[model samples]
Target: MNRRGFLMTASAAAAGFALAQAPGAAFAAPVRKALPRLKTQQVGSGDINFGYHSAGPEEGRPVVLLHDFGYDIHSFTEVIPLLAEQGFRVLVPYMRGHGSTRFKDKSIARSAQPEALGADTLTVIDSLHHPEAVVAGFGQGAVAARAFAQLKPTRCKGIVAVDGLWRPVPERAALQKDRRGFARKLWTANSPDWRFDEAVFARAAVSFDNPDFAAILTDTPSNAAVPTVSAPVLTLRGSASGIPVDDPTARMIEGAGHNLPLEAPQAFADAIAEMVRNAKWRT
Candidate 1:
């Protein structure tokens, strides 16, 4: 079957969800307190210390959520609770060089190359003792998700790629000049439909302060050889993005841009839930 056949054009209705909260609305204190608190933890993997946030029942089916470049785990803030409530074990890891994740050895290369990021996903899953998981991500996180699927197909029940899957190109020299400005520009350019305030942007932007952020952002040879994915895949794109609609699976998310998790949390979470329900591994 064609790979594009995996694409399911998701909407709130089709995914069995309703947009109860206003877009970008802050959750009420009582509602927030009602949800399971995200447990922050770290695991030593290779030369990197991987930090991740997890929630939901311990025995719940595992689902790993990866955030895009220029953003951190908070990118999935809205989506996390939605999935957790549905009894999915949600794990959101800070990619290497982001958040509390750091290189253990000072001399170790700080590279966010797709292969390295993909390997980290597997490590996070293994460290957490999950047999397998539904891997989903946005932007560069999408790339990592795809890579993980290729690397260890059996471990990934399915993958939901939001916006687009991007291949990184090293531009460290130029990016180094104005990292924050670069990220700000990405937010404006990628999600033209979403009007995020300074506070929202600041929440994720602070992650760029990691010492190795620049190296990882700009470090690359663009030469991670990955095998063809044998696992089921779902591809989603924002109506506002430049991603082509040629593929059969290319479903455009109305009113969303490249940042689907933040701009359209309900739809994003719904996609993952859909994948979980349909996954062959689900017991």
Candidate 2:
């Protein structure tokens, strides 16, 4: 199907499905009063200066939360505190070409390949002096999380991926021509249940203004490799998302959309917590 046709079908699918929840089924929302202000920090990681938000105790079990495409660290604003309360040190980083993250070397290509992103993840973990971390990711961030696990399984305790692991689009030029329009369509199609205001979108949209945004989005590695992930994996999908489930063990978050972290922060954090409790790491 053509792009237009594909989008139409996806939007319809997103609108048609409603989460089948039992009566009185509910999840806890993040408490505003208990939420602590996340401290912003920067780390020099290879070619990139990574800017990230850190929360919870310094010695708490590490949990890295990676945001999806078209979003930044702010995507997990509510979710971070909940994990922190559970004694997990949460680190939400702005991906390359997003927010305050910048490339240090001018000659280096601005690439968002799985390998590049995975390397960045390792840098974050090493910067914190942690042996291993339970990594959680949303959308494109999920791809990164998976990449990190494959690249360095020993350093990844477990993985929580939501609506991730999609193959790259073949028509890169066509999509690159209208990045913003394409992003808007994806938002509407994948999150039909979400009624996000312009203010919320604008907050994340500003990250797109980075000079390397277009280059990173359009860059496609010739050999995009996916090694086997040995770490325990917990896959998730939003009830109303248009993305298909590739993992048989994937759990559906009730009443959520494509932006699972934003729409269901409680469920997202809970999944990470569960992975941390269940996954066994090599000693």
Best TM-score among the predictions, by candidate number: 1
lDDT scores in order: 0.69, 0.69
Tens digit per residue, CA lDDT, model 1, 1-283: 1110111111111111122222332211122112222457888657788888988878788889988777788878899899999998889998776788888888887876667777999989777778789999876677788778877888789988874334434334545786666565555545545677666766677677888887775564333343368788788787875332344576667888767887889998888999998888734
- Positional deviation of residue 137's Cα in model 2 after best superposition, in angstroms: 0.3
lDDT of 2 at 117: 82
Residue 98 of model 2 has an lDDT of 78
Clash-forming residue pairs, model 2: none
lDDT digits (tens) for residues 52-95 of candidate 2: 88888777778999886656677788898899898877888888
lDDT of 1: 0.69
